[model samples]
Target: MKNVETNKKIIQKKQVKIYYLSPEYVYYPIYNNNPKFFVKSKSNVFKETLLFEDNNTKNYSNISGQVMGMKNISGKNYLVLKNDFHEKYSAPKSFRRKVNKLTKKEILDILNENDAASYSSDIKYFINNFESIDSLILNLLICEDSDKIYSEVFNKYNSDILEMFDAISQIFEISNPVIMLSDTDDKNIEFVTNLSGMYPDIRIVLSHDKYPASHPLLITRKLNLSNALVLSSMDLYYLYSIVKRNKKVSEKMILISGDALNSDFIVETKLNVLISDIISLCKIKLTEDDVLCKNSAIRAEVVSIDDTIDTTVDAIIIAKKGNNNPKECINCGLCNKNCPQKINPQMYKLNNLPFPGKCINCNMCSYVCPRMIRKDI
Candidate 1:
């Protein structure tokens, strides 16, 4: 029995890849020579200390599996653990106290401190306006990369999504919390169903459609559901931190991806950190023609280096700017077909058709266009 327990500990302590990013520090696994070696941030930590004995032999099948936690202190990056080998690095006593003794006012104060007061107001508004809500839908779908980061963190922490739901329900005295998954893939559905099975009150709804299915407006329209308070997985995670962990919304998990990037990364960093700082840490070199877009590649708005990181900025895409030359549309109908909202791009462009407010701005119309016309024009 002792041997089995010891083996379990060994398996749990197995070294995994960790990528720590902060304004002052960055540590990401480099796979060319050795998968375990990580480039240090601005810290003076020795390279020898970052590598593990089994890193050479251990295959890093999934980089997300390796990320344990991310921390930032006094604008400086501290130690990055390759594995959660010890609980000494656990939550601080103050944090534990906050989690244990959470109140509505305390949670609200934390949200306000983190620039998330709008969320508190929204919850209050909902509670005040509605006597009973049909369901509280937690949207698990963001863009592909953002969804991956959300799932990984949720799984890594073994977080109970229902805990957030319970807290909200208790506060409002509302019942029926549902998780809405926009992906219909067998694997994704199975995973969501399994996680939701542990909570009897929580149910799963599979939308399983193309792009824009995750959009709140579209979800509500398609699901024929009303009086539903829709929340993103990130939002719920923040709620969990407030109610259960007594943690502030200090950092956010974001995906940095694009053709111009040396490599894609799922990074967590301090809130309101400068985009320039993150780019520097990622070692991304931007050319004159490179463009940076926040959130989804399809729907997100273009941002600049001057912008600071925010909760809504899920993914940062650094890609080469498209051709500036605009050509007349050929009326291929490709744009209309690809559009998840079924809006006629050619009509909107040529005929000056009234703008459809339903447009989710999923740049698919621009992507499918042969003439490279700007859809926003």
Candidate 2:
């Protein structure tokens, strides 16, 4: 009778359910350690699982004072770093110095003194051939759904999209400013139309029929524009704050999503915060075998929870481990047919041709593969 009772307890433990939430889908329990069986469409559970209230306001640290110098490379100007910007500005003593003490000439001189090989082009461009930019391209397709997390964050921050457009125009002396959106779904297209209607001076272009349509090179090719500057929505927001409000790039907007999360929401936090810290704040629980992916599942790399978050990270995804025991390739030729860049993935592996330099690493071939081979190999 004791053995029978022990068996019953073991069965109960095996049946324990684990719920996970993502921006677009949800899943429950672990069956054979596979997420395929549990995947389902997102539902009203998102409202209850919201980690942050709609009206909650967060104060972010500012670091515009550390704008060491600007480097113009290949028609784009990048903000050079100075004096451990992310760290020093996030520290307690950062507020003691109310204003940035460095002048434009002083910042340039510092850039010259550093004189690293990597800094050569930028320093030389800024010194010799500095010209006012002509155009700015605002990329709004970074989020999976523009109407969901991104628009919510934009409205919550009380940022005016038109105001941002004007600010960037004036700062860069840009005459042709364009807002590019990827037409992945009907809702995204509708949102882009409504936004474009509000701003007459800004041009809106929709990219269709590509996996990574929002990629900078792809956007430049699709739009047929040259010498144009590209900036993400987050980048424009920070730039507006910097030029108008004297703010800095101290805070970052992060999208927390994936099947392993209990709830998925967008959170604004200080730069350099540890990934573990953000997970704790959201009250996320992870099992020993579950995996955490930085950015998108298709393009980003898997990282440990202990890693420190970088400024460029836009998304954090938690997912079950992928199936390593893939079946043999059936050679249905679907990988070649569906490849957006038209590279023969199968033939590339066989060394029938040189390396596919045009491959964008979008993972579409692997996604469409019947045998689950890694095309990126």
Candidate 3:
């Protein structure tokens, strides 16, 4: 075979390439007549107490409401009780004393906080009026917690996620469909497997691992499917209805993790959210003195959290120093030795190579560094 100069002709002749261009994002405004659909809301912390003598309440007991609380202050907000529910708390310290308590209402509030119309109303308009199915498009729905599904919106419609999965199964019925599970939790595996098995030619392949092993895209790759639709584990039913009814998605799912003042919780935020806002969501503390990192050490660097509260900020690593000089390669060969994909990173740095073709951007070199030198792309 002659040396292939251009990928275009060769790729076309050999049919070794696949082209599936991402479509232009078109927002389909979902409208529902009856509002009050459930959505995960931004957690709010309110300090309250029954201001009375003998504040010696052994524990803030007998308070009853449908509340979902977390033990770890690292990734979520904790509610603090200063006064009884009867007494109205004051401002300033009252707000600071109690941690944010996340609820569906709070999530909806954040979604429509900027817009004049309420998010509930927005949802209702879409659910009730929209009739076109062609408007549905793909959305990258994400969930942070491994076990739980992130059900924020789309809970009120008849076409829920489970039904959507059934539809997708029907579409892929020609292929031997298998359900792959990412978590070791047997209950989750059982539920998903049983649900997937309802369709005619689909079978279950359960895998309990830490990573997203059950991701349909990854599974499809193994199954060698021509096309695949990836859906989030959270509210598969809701997403299904949204896709089936409106046939479109305006937003994409993003996960916020790492060090911050607040605990980590999934929020349905806009795409343009800034880095600063994301830090506030993490619930992890970051003083001027603190540093943050994310993904891997090589990819980690300093980030500023101000003005912007968005998911993009959470993935950043807050560094202590700025890049003094794009440090010259030390020829330690460590980058080569540590590469999981067997690519020579040190050579790329030394030669100032135009492109390191095999570089997967794993950031392994940055992780093994003693001086914390930022990795070159």
Q: Best-fitting candidate, measured by lDDT?
A: 1
Per-residue lDDT for 1-377 in model 2, tens only?
00011011101011111121111111111112222211122211211121111122121212222223334434433222222222332223212121124344443343333221111232233333324446677766543321233444454442344566654464335678887765654555576567666556778776653445666667777788876666665554543344333334445567667644445657776554556667767777877756776665555478767554444566676666656445676887877876767788878744445447898876656655656566544
Off by over 4 Å in 3: 1-159, 172-178, 183-187, 206-241, 244-255, 259-263, 268-285, 289-340, 368-377
lDDT of 1 at 196: 64
Say which candidate scores most in TM-score: 1
Which should have the higher lDDT, number 1 or number 2? 1
TM-score, one value per model: 0.66, 0.59, 0.41
Q: List the pairs of residues colliding in candidate 1.
A: 26-41
Candidate 2 lDDT for residue 366: 63
Model 2, residue 105: what's the lDDT? 47
lDDT by residue (tens digit), candidate 3, 1-377: 01111111101011111111111111111122232312212222232212111222111111211123212233322222211233222333211111123233332333233221211232433233323211221222222221222322222221244455444444323233344443444554455555554554445454433222334444555546543433343334333423333212223343343322233344444322334444554444556555554421134444434222222222343334433345555666665676655776666655656536655565555544433333564
Q: Candidate order by lDDT, highest to lowest? A: 1, 2, 3
lDDT of each: 0.55, 0.48, 0.34
Would you list the clashing residue pairs of candidate 2? 64-248
Regarding TM-score, does 1 or 2 come out ahead?
1
Of 1 and 3, the candidate ranking higher by TM-score: 1
Q: TM-score of predicted model 2?
A: 0.59
- TM-score: model 1 vs. ground truth: 0.66
